[model samples]
Target: MKTSGNRVWLTYVLSDSDVPNALTLCFSLRRVLTSRRLAVIVSPKVSRVSREALSYGFDFVFTLDEERNTAGLENEDFVKLFALTLQGFEKCVMLSPNMLVVKNCDELLDKEEDVQQTFVFAENGDSSILRLRPSLQVFNCLLKQLAKRNGTGVDSILKKWLSDQTSQLTFIDDKYNQHLHEKASFLREEKNIAIVNLKNKTPHELDYVGEMVLQLWKSIYDKSVLPLLNAVANVRNQLL
Candidate 1:
């Protein structure tokens, strides 16, 4: 695998249930990304076995410090914020585990921008696939806002924060982060989509387009992720 010194594809795993999604995302990314490195931030809720499986596909596996003040945040939203604190990376594409990369995303890292700015898909203005220059300053600013707006979802806080700085915010084409549950008729043709966000539903629950995307996701899981996970489990059992 090739490696880019300053660009990385980042994701997070907050629990054992998220392991499959993260691994699938990592494998899908590996298929399309040649130079960019892959990384994942895992919370304590994830098992050792799961972490081992993730380490197989991702170049870096970060552990979220349990001491961090993440109270009242659902799904360990605070862990995603840590992407900003990742020193040494010029650009980081933070993606949600539920997303499947359908094509090359190198164009995202090629965008020339300062650390004060952030790039996100126009679809949800959420963190489904966010591109930002890693900076401690921005990370702290978001943490302060998160505290002020207790009980608010991180996506809401991020949207409001970005809204406050319209000039610094860049909305990428919605094709980059298409939500699977949305009406298929409203979306661009499947060939143009860069990523598919399988919001909480399986392929069987979706329409034809969604079924196709989920079928691809399942294919990656079975051909790549599942085999790696099985190998990890086998090695683990032998040690025990």
Candidate 2:
């Protein structure tokens, strides 16, 4: 496999209900991502309109199928592992859809030069990246570690694995995966958040969560964030 000479940002959208926020996520990345490729793994449950919208923002949009071996994987979560299978990608970063990219995270792209370690994970959120050279081995390690933990979400498994520190993974700063709770006001004024993770929030909850995300975007991209907010509104309209 050849290198894409850059990293690829990977995310998943399992159903039509998740489309708008996922698109919002990719759109924000399009605004600030300087040199990384972007892709999304969609499932059969996604509607045509949502799929078409994804094409606009992602470089490659993979749809799940029997051949993809995604059967029985809750929310098509297993498909994230397939990102390691992509040819020509030197590195791949996986993020949950609810996470909003607030600034250029290209700095996170710098891997340890020796390449002995293959995974770099965020401290506070599910976002993680892997340098591809040893990705297959790393992916296998994760699958084995997580296999018996049925009913447990992939994020939790990886979070526990990385949090242990005894693991071979490199840890990225918590600022890259800032959360929007408990101290939302403080996080806003700090203004150093790179990716905003809205984990476990329902769609209706995202309405309020979005306000904080928009505020961050407003600070970084200025007025350009308005059109993106409008785009999200447009998608919400389609849902209704």
Candidate 3:
């Protein structure tokens, strides 16, 4: 897969239960961003209906089995690494499924005159908006580096990567990666939250997304697309 001229956004689902959440993320991306090359890497555990729903929002859908090299990692969390193998993209942005885009991402990766790094990452998280120039060699190097480590989870691997590749990375605005540390404070500060992180998927988190989804729909699309997106979430919630 050689996607050297495309601007692609990548994400993945680990189980059938994550289908709806992933779809909501896709719909949110489609609603706010001008990019059309959104893709989702779904696992074999997801149902056909869930996959179909995924396809409705994304430009392309891939399965974990297709990404053989990414299999066998602890918790299947390494699945996000599949973005490196994505074909036909000049630039790739790997985003977590729970991140809500509060701003247009069309120029998210445009380098500033003062900047020198090759990557832009949303701060304070293992993974959020990761903008990178697609390179298989670099990804392979990271894989080998990760394999040599003793730690076995996404956060540990990510921290190691950041520490090792600090020269290549620049931080994006913290506002783009907001967290709900204090629920009341977050609610009071909704005006400042850009891309929210739904880490635990708590009820308030879902409710926050519910309200934001409506705002996104009203501002970009209509209410009709809500049911399908909601159905995807409902299905995943049932599995959870």
List clash counts for every candidate, in order.
0, 1, 6
What is the TM-score (0 to 1) of candidate 3? 0.72
lDDT of each: 0.78, 0.63, 0.63
Per-residue error (Å), model 2, residue 90:
1.5
Worst 10 residues of 1 by lDDT: 67-76
Best-matching candidate per lDDT? 1
lDDT of candidate 1 over 172-240, digit per residue (tens) = 677777888776642446677888878767545567778778788999999998899999999999999
Range of the 10 consecutive residues with the lowest summed lDDT in candidate 2: 125-134
TM per candidate: 0.87, 0.69, 0.72
Better of 2 and 3 by TM-score: 3
Any runs in candidate 2 off by more than 4 Å, and if so which?
Answer: 1-4, 66-72, 125-168, 184-189, 200-212, 215-240
TM-score of 1: 0.87
**Candidate 2 accuracy as lDDT:** 0.63
Query: Worst ten-residue run, lDDT, model 3?
Result: 109-118
Q: Write the per-residue lDDT of candidate 3 for residues 1-240, one digit (tens) a residue.
A: 533237776778877777656766676776675545788888877777678777888888977754445434643556656566665576667777766666665555444521333356666554666766656776677677676666576656665675676655566766666654446646666766656665554444444644564466344334434577567768778888
**Which runs in model 3 stand beyond 4 Å of their true positions?**
1-5, 65-67, 112-119, 152-168, 183-192, 202-226, 229-240
Model 2 Cα lDDT, one tens digit per residue, 1-240: 544455677788888767656766777887784577788888888877677777776788987653544334454557666665655567667777777787888765555442554456554444433323336665566767766777787867856765573445556777666666636543454557677766644334344545666565445434443354457558878898
